[model samples]
Target chain A: MIGAERVGAAAAEPSEAIRLEGVRKAFGGDEVLRGIDLSVATHEVICLIGASGSGKSTMLRCVNLLEPVDGGRILLWGEDITSPAVDVNAVRRQIGIVFQSFNLFPHMSVLRNVTLAPIRVLRMSRREADVRADELLGRFGLADKRDDYPDRLSGGQQQRVAIVRALAMQPRIMLLDEVTSALDPELVAEVLNVIRELAQAGMTMLIATHEMGFARDIASRVCFLDQGVILEQGPPQRIFTEPREERTRRFLQSIIEAGRM
Target chain B: MLGGGRAVVVSTVSTIVFFGLIAAAFLFAPGSAQVRQEFFNLHDMKVALVGDPSHGVFSVGEAFLRNIEMFLIGEVLILALALLIAVVRQLRGPVFFPLRLVAIAYTDFFRGVPLILVIYTIGFGIPALGLRVVSTQSAEVYGLAALVLSYSAYVSEVYRAGIESVHESQTAAARSLGLSQWQALRFVVLPQAVRRVIPPLLNDFISLQKDTALVAILGTVIEANRAAQIYSSYAFNYSSFVLAALMFLVLTVPLARFTDHLIARDRRRRQAGGGR
Candidate 1:
């Protein structure tokens, strides 16, 4: 069982969990993340929704400090993570990331993939790491694939292994960037099943995904991001049936209509 | 538009005309003298023909052939040395600026200068500094040493370019999995790079075949070109020289085709997303 109190350190209140103010990032002339402010609460699964190139991925990346922000402050569990003196690596260790492409190490076995970071970065002994890795693999129903390489597994199996890898690190917050986007239509459910399981277990998760059903079903709150801003947000049921913002209503209509026709 | 009979007739006529011109030029040519004196040629070097040089063209000595074989063994050793140096240089310097700089200097010096000059400098000039001319087994050794020294530079850069052709993402993926830079290169990059470089390396090996001719300048008697010189001097005949030319083609052409086959195989494998 996880220590829920520390986990909520990641999400005490919408204001206290992740506080970002006037956050900005740019590469050359293009500014991807403009000045923005947002908060996420404890025991919450916040789904970031947006069109392509709308900066939803960048926002998720920012939370993990995978992409450094040029300005503003990112506070994780009351610690000012944006300070230059802060060890970004330590912050990264607490915040785990899973990418859309399922960037699993191709050269490692499925078990090794889950075990490497714990043994290397966490400095866990090999035997202990192996023990933890086996337990995790069994939970994900990948015990048979412990010795198989990433290339040998199905895309769904690989992504599940990826999630287990992040989970093995025991991160306070798990940042999932379109985790099922690369999966085949039939395979998407397998990966999403694992994500749903994590959300139910009270993982502090921020997911950038296109699956509206997943957002409506599992998300505590949903934020529609467009042009690098949070256009609108609310409870999944309210946003789905009674969106107050025009942009959120229009986005929902497009997806529902696309599904119908 | 033209048919097969027309092609055959044209080929037969051209063949007759070519042979006719050759016969007319050689047989009916003016003042082609046997007037060259025997003193102009050293018949003793004709030792290569009968594997002997006891009294020159009229005689054969097995000792000369043995010396030539000894020289050949030495040159092979030199080639091995050069290959080792090039591979080591490539493996050592994919990232370090200083290593790259040293590589650039090596290839630049060797490629920028002529091979004959490199051979002569190592062959004769080094001996003037008390290197003692390496007259026995070292004759072949010194020639081959220069050959390997000159060629290794070109081979190293070919390897470097092959290494770079592997995408940066491959390394990034490996490192993200907790591998160090060298480990990433060793486990991910170099294997693919080496496979891709095989055609160019084989091409390098072909160049090495002809480059062996440069050893003649250093007085090694192992190789065909030098053996040609020895045969011509002893019997005063040019047939063996022709035979040596034929032998070099026999070795190089087939090897080059085999290398081409490997290149094509790798390209096809890449198309299918197989490992390099």
Candidate 2:
């Protein structure tokens, strides 16, 4: 199944969207991402699954250039974004990232939050940005919340607004770092539904998620990270079902026992 | 649980008793009568407040206008200058090292020296230079400049604290959406940071308002404090000083209360889990 999926992926999109080659990152003395190499094709939805502190979010952050890599290079659409000459702001423009905590600008209304990057970074006129933001917000069932502050919204609503804010940039790819993790259990489904809608719309995404079931349903490929490396990866069907790495099985067992899957 | 009405009654009674005892202690103290005669004379206070200008006594009320003018101008300059310094200090990388160094030195020098010394230096020392443009400025200008310089250092630190208090994740989120560092600071980080620090900023402004009195040391400014000093010396009574103190309290007490209100609102907002 993994082999067939790769063959089809290559045929559909001949170019890679994001490629990480031996990416390494450390915070203080702790090396979070020892060496990671992964390639994501256009329109591909790759889910990174791992335990806490396994460097899933770090990998996503490094891809977005939010965290500078200690070693190696990251290429976005065949251009080496990690090169010294590459402008980080310009590089970040092509990729949008939604965070776990939904770090919306608390001081801004939802419309302003969504329109900020489009106006400032993209240089879109305020009116144009507002129209784009409104469309995105309306699509995500957040149209009524356009003038509301993030604090006025529910956790799920804020996360959805965050997604709309990222989408307003019209980024080539989106990185979701446990976007639903901060939501209440009841609120989680609303945020997850938004991601599912994005997936259906064929938005290229690299998602760091704890939802094993969601990963099995939405991801083209699932990468299980262990101790700062991609320990195992395959089509989600194969990775979730087959006996491969003992660590992967143990991780799955714990999730199953915890009734999360 | 204490009943609501009973709790209010208890607190009101306790407050009155607490203050009444302190008042009685001062009233019955040795030489209280002498102190009252000198400092609390209603006639002297009225004379100082409604000054007999024909008799060469500057009205404390009229002279207080100068303090207000100094405070208004100095407060505006200090806010602008301090924010600039705070933003400069926030600049990163090797290229900004020199600018950052200058900002650090400025805050250190001003904060280390007393405000009065700065006033003395800027007021007298600048005139000594005999530089045509600067030397010709009024005593009020020199005094106001000193207040701005000194208070800016303290207020810049407050702004810096606000900037630093904003979580790093806010910056990350902004940057990831393709905002430059400055754009992030201007739009995302600063608005939240400034909102968070407003209570403290108002607290600093209250101090700045009171410190406006310090300009009287220039001798030529003739602000409320100077007027009070002159009146006290002439009448051999300190009641004029009490009137000056009341003037300061009239301005600062409301400001202090406003600051408290801001702090309470901020606390309530946070406790209610984030709102404007």
- lDDT of each residue in A1-261, candidate 2, tens digit only: 212343455556646889999999999999999899999988899999999999999999999988889998999988999988999999888898999999998888999999999999989999999887888888889999999988899999999999988888877789999998888999999998988988876778999999999999999999999989999999999999994999999999999999999
Q: What is the lDDT of residue B115 in candidate 2?
A: 94
Model 2: per-residue Cα lDDT over B1-276, one tens digit each: 899999999999999999999999989999899999999999999999988878789999999998888888888899899999999999988999999999999999999999999999999999999999989899999999999999999999999999999999999999999999999999988887888788888888888888888988889998999999999988999999999999999999999998898888878877887643
Clash count in backbone of candidate 2: 0
Q: How would you encode candidate 1's per-residue C-alpha lDDT over A1-261 as one tens digit per residue?
A: 344545455444444567778788887888877876888766579998878887888887777665679998888977898887987557777777787777776656888778877877688999999998998899889999999977778889888988888888887788888988888889999899988888877777899989999888899999888777887888989888898888878888898888921
Error of 1 at B82 (Å): 13
TM-score of chain A of each: 0.93, 0.94
Candidate with the greatest lDDT versus the true structure? 2
What lDDT tens digits, residue by residue, belong to model 1 across residues B19-125? 99987776565633332222122343333445553543322233233334433553465345444444456454346666656656777898788888988887777
lDDT for predicted candidate 2 compared with the true structure: 0.91
Candidate 1 yields a Cα-based lDDT of: 0.72
TM-scores of the models, in the given order? 0.67, 0.92
Give the TM-score, chain B only, in order for the candidates: 0.69, 0.94
* Residue B49 in candidate 2, Cα distance off native in Å: 2.5
Interface RMSD of 2: 1.8
State residue B47's C-alpha deviation in candidate 1, in Å. 7.5
Stretches of candidate 1 above 4 Å error? A1-19, A39-44, A62-66, A75-95, A105-135, A146-152, A165-172, B1-172, B175-276
